[model samples]
Target: MAKIKVLILDNDTTSRDILNKSLEESKDIEVVGIAFNEKIALDKMRLLNPDAVIFGNNFNDLSASLFTKKLLEAYPGKGVIIITDSNSKNQASDTIEALGHGAFDVVLRPDPNISDIEKIKFIERNLSSKIRCFSIKKFSRMARLLTPIEETQPYNGNFKPSCVKKYENSKFEIVLIGVSTGGPEVLTNLIPEIPKNFPIPILIVMHMPKIFTKPMSDSINRVSKIKFKEAEDNEVLKTGTGYLAPGGIHLIIRRNLKGELYVLFEDTPPVNSCKPAVDVLFKSAVGIVREKAISVVLTGMGSDGTEGVRALKENNVPCIVQDKESSVVWGMPGSVAEAGLADEILPLNMIAKRLTDLVMK
Candidate 1:
């Protein structure tokens, strides 16, 4: 296996050294270059062509957002992770903004007051793991694109190409979506496209930290014509209102004695290494709605939704997967596509229209 070449960008000498030493400790990672400013970073990127770049908290002269955007524009396939202070007053907003600007991921730096040994351990464990994950995803994407279409099955045996014609008898009751990694940005683009009068409750399971999910919900809601907020335990599900699965807990659907559907937040242990996992939400939806459910798997980094999608398919529920061309990472949706489970595979822009057509028609 080839080592993941990395470039460290940080104006702070201590931070640069910490990231360099920690990342170098990994057997599969090699530090190719270091840059203390945007100009130097650009130069290093051209010269080294590293697999990933780690950006520290402070940029020498450029705004973090601008720098990130410019870097991504210049190096489209290269992975970028921004390190921020965990204790910062603006951590949530900053992290969200960075993600919106196209940074691959964000890592919170260890508390500055910690012992040097502990700080090194923290950097190694957190930063190195993120770098490896990013690099693996980068390589996986390249591999998928390079492989011939004939070698890869583009359409599944169970694939339903047109939901409008195929599910004439199916009454869509709910929209259940599963996303991760690049979810927020995709949601930002998708949620607003869903019109206010669209009549179906939408439940989303996005893998995010406890502090970040609420802000993400707020951010989406601000731009969307349809309202969205974090799911509250026992809240009755309603149409035209999207519910985001709260972080640190799984969001499932259940019925009260009156047979009315409501959101149930579970404290159950993480499934597929993700709390509020798509599987949990999709399974819950399947139990209640069965064939009436409309399951959509969006861009994400893992196969968290594959099993749940399988269960939905078993019940004759319609499933939609985001097309690979429009996905930031196709792992979740691709798994369903590979399993021959999706009813329709559409690009991101077409998904909202299809959802509305399926529910309203």
Candidate 2:
């Protein structure tokens, strides 16, 4: 396989050198160029046409946000990953804004207190993995596939019922979504389409870092009519709101003595190599919501949610999978489909509407 070409952008010479050295250490990645500012980065991007760009926090004299927006608009298909220092003020908000504007992912710079060897190792591990994932052709294809709901099929409000007879008579109390890889983009498009008055609480498990989940929820909340936020331990589950499983932790629902539902965060080891594994949440919901749960497996890179969907299916819960053509990577949803677990396999645009109809009606 050809090496993934990358361009580094940073105003700090030390930072640029660290990233350049760390990234090139991987045989699968090649550092095509390094730029100290927006102008230089744009020129390098135009000349080198690297597969992805590692954008440092400082953009010399230009505005970082403006630079990111222009870079994406100018290059169109190239991926941009943002790097932020741990001590930066409002780093979460900044990272979220960058993601909303089109940056593929965000990685934090190692704390200055760490040893040089540790920092280099951390940078190499994180940056190289992101570069490789972003360079995949499927991601680029999904980016092109994203379009406004109006442009796709109209919402007919006609949805087929679940295959299991138990679900036909049961009322859906919660909506669970499992997504990864292209999740942020998919959520940005799907969440805002859900109306504020829609019934049932929604829980989402999107594979992301500890620092990114809150910001991801905030970004979705800003555009969405229904409230969206990171799930908090012991917080009561409510209708007309969406909860995102915090990154690096497992989110599960539990009932208190009063029979009211609340959120629980687990520090258990990762399942299927995912901390907030979909199976963890789905399995928990199986005991709480039972046949009334509605499960969705969206675009992702692996089969993390397949077992969870199967568990839900065995209990007669309704499962929805994003169709193959609309996904960045069809691993998760495809797994559920192949298992004959999904009740509906629909495109991204129709998901929110179908979900609303199921819960609200």
Candidate maximizing TM-score: 2
Q: Assess the local accuracy of residue 345 in candidate 2 as a C-alpha lDDT between 0 and 100.
A: 86
| lDDT per residue (tens digit) for residues 272-360 in model 1 | 99998999888887778878888999988779999999888777888889888767678999999899888788866667767877788
Q: Which stretches of candidate 2 lie over 4 Å from their true place?
A: 58-64, 86-89, 111-117, 138-140, 143-145, 155-169
lDDT values for all models: 0.80, 0.82
- Residues 56-145 of candidate 2 have per-residue lDDT tens digits of 876445554566688878877778888886555466667667677677777888877888678789899877877777776434566544
TM-score of 2: 0.89
Cand. 1 Cα-lDDT = 0.80
What's the TM-score of every candidate structure? Answer: 0.81, 0.89
